[model samples]
Structures are given as C-alpha cells and as structure tokens.
Target: MSQPKHATPEQARPFLEAFKFFYQINDASANFFMRNTYPISIKKGTMLHKAGDICNHIYFITKGAVRGYVNDNGKEKITWISVENEMVTSIYSYYMQQPSLENMDAIEDCEILSMSHEKLNELYNLEPSVNILVRRILEKYYADAEVRALTSRFSDADTKYEFFLNTYSHLANRIPLTYIASFLGINLETLSRVRAKKRSIKKS
Candidate 1:
C-alpha cells in the first residue's frame, strides 16, 4: 500500500531543488507549496494510477522508478519510464480532469512527492513562479517525448537499444529487462541478443 503523509523538507528536497533551478521563490511561497504536497512510499508493483481512473495528482519521484503503460488487447505496452528527479503522471488526465488511458506503476520501491490537482491549480493561480518552473519542466519532457516518438518509429533494434542506453543506462541494471524491452518496443529475445552483441563488442 502507498501511504501519503506530510513531507519533511528532506523528503521534499528533490522538488525544491528542481523548482529553485527554474524559478527562485521566497520562503513563504515555497512553504505554501510544501504544505500542499505530501510524500508517499510505495513498494514495487504498486499501481499509482490505473486506466479509467481520474489521475488526481502529479508525482515527483524522489527515489526509485515508475513506468507509464497501457493494456493493448491484454498486452502491456510501456509508454514511458521515469526515475528520480523526474515527474510522472497521466498528463492529459491530470490536466483535463478526465479518466486516464495509461496506468502508472512503481517498478521499484519508490518515495514520491504528490500534489493534488486542486492544489496544483491553486498554486498556478497564486504563484506565478510556479508556472515558470512547470513550463520549463514540461518543455523538457515534450522534447524528450518527441525524441522517443521519432526513435520508436524510425530506429532499428540496435539503434533503439543504444538510444535507451544513452538515455536510461542508469536504469538498465536497476529495473527488469522485460520492462526495458517493452519501453523500447522490442521483444525480450531481441534485447537479450542486443545485450550479448554489445558485450562482445566491448570485450573485443
């Protein structure tokens, strides 16, 4: 089970650092933002949000990893993976207040800062700097998404695995190969062969 509790400054450090990087705000505004958010600890395999559920909050991963995936005729297709210092949520569902088509799950035991949709809107209205930080974050994710779209469509299995290594090499050994294969839009055998081929190249 995921427990949502008041977050201490230590637990909120990642969010604070990210926020300060883009928009430096005073203690008062920062405090207000802190008060509205909470920390949650979830074990691996926990489903943070499920398809058909309205995603009520956006999460900032402080530890571990999560993946956004969808059921495609009983098959699970990974849409994206997020690790620490990154934000994860069903974007359209959170922004439009609609049921999500994607499901978010923890791939490893995770600690995350969560802010409800209501509180997020309040912050947007009251704190102009929040908008600046969010805009910058969104712009970054948008660019990454564009790269992912192009790579998934045009790249070969080797190129895709190489791109995944460049982008998420840190997670390569941390998470399951099955999840990585799904995210890369390749099968397990192909990923295994690619790994073996890469290993041989490195050795030779």
Candidate 2:
C-alpha cells in the first residue's frame, strides 16, 4: 500500500456515492467526509491488513480487488473477495481494536479511499446522521458474513462451484484461478474439472 493522500473531489465522489446508497448525506456532511478521508494506491500482492496487526481503518475500493484469507499451516484459505465499489476491512480488528486473524491483500492493483477509525468515530459524534449511515453499512456487512459462512459449509464441490459462478462469474477471467479455488473451499483439480464440465455442457 502506498502512502495515503488527501482525496480530490473526483477521488472522493465514489466513496461518498457508496455511502449514499445506505443513508442520505447532505452537502455539509459530504464535504466533511471528503476532507477526512484519504486516497491510497495498493500494488497487487500487497497486504493491506495482516494477521496479528491491528486494522486501523476501513477502506472503500474505487478500483480493483482485495481478498481476505488466512494462512492455515502454510496453506492459504481464502475467506472472501471484494471488488470495486465495495468495502473491505478486518472487521473484528477494526471494531474491537484487536489483532486481525486474517490478512487482507490486493489481488489486483487497487485505488481505495480510507478513513481512520478515529475520524469515523468523530463523525458519528458530530454528525448524528453518520450514526445511521454506519449502522446500515454494518448491517449489510453482517448479512454478507452470514451468507459467506453458510456457503463455506456446502459439502458438494459442484454445488459450491455453481454458487460461486452465480455470485462471482464476472471475476472468473479476471483473478487467478488458484485464489478462486481457495475461496470456494475446493482443490484446484476439483475446480478445473468443474470448469471443464461446465464448458462441455455449454458446447452440447
């Protein structure tokens, strides 16, 4: 990740627009938020938040992708992949100020907008509407977490692959297949076979 710099109006628009989807933000609040948040550029393969490190801020992806994963006895177990126009962070660490258990890294070179925990809290206190905005955002995060947890338990690799395709088919050609296989909780060989089967079915 590169050093964060103050965001220009153009850079801040997408971040503000993402928030507007959850809650109404008046001009004053939008201006204040733009002033507080910063822009960062992350190189592919760079770790934004690492295990055992406290996550200091939450990030909004304006471009590219990030993946959340854990090192399980030297193997990577991918938990989630977030693309542009989405929020990405070490949730537990960001909220509780504890060390993160997973790593968040850039899967592709990325541009992101970020606001520190301290600045966010200040917004909550100073602008009451910001509380509603954050609550709505957290609710969506929790719902997505629940869905991911349920999906991870699927026992059939075919069913898992189907679900992944339904949700992330757009990313299939963009990201590494190894990362996609890990995210689906399937071995690479299994994923390849599944893809082959899908292709053959399409041709028939």
Q: Could you say which candidate leads in lDDT?
A: 2
True-structure RMSD for candidate 1: 2.2
lDDT score of model 1?
0.88
Q: Estimate each model's TM-score.
A: 0.93, 0.95
lDDT tens string, model 2, 81-164?
999999988999999999999999999999999989999888878888888888999999899888778778899888888887
Structure candidate 2, residue pairs in collision:
none
> What is the Cα-based lDDT of residue 18 in candidate 1?
80
CA lDDT of each candidate? 0.88, 0.90
Q: Which stretches in model 1 have alpha-carbon errors above 4 Å? A: 1-5
Error of 2 at 110 (Å): 0.7
Those runs of model 2 whose alpha carbons end farther than 4 Å from true positions after fitting are 1-4
lDDT of 1 by residue, 38-92 (tens): 9889999999999999999999999999999999999999999999998999999
Compared with the true structure, the alpha-carbon lDDT of candidate 2 equals 0.90
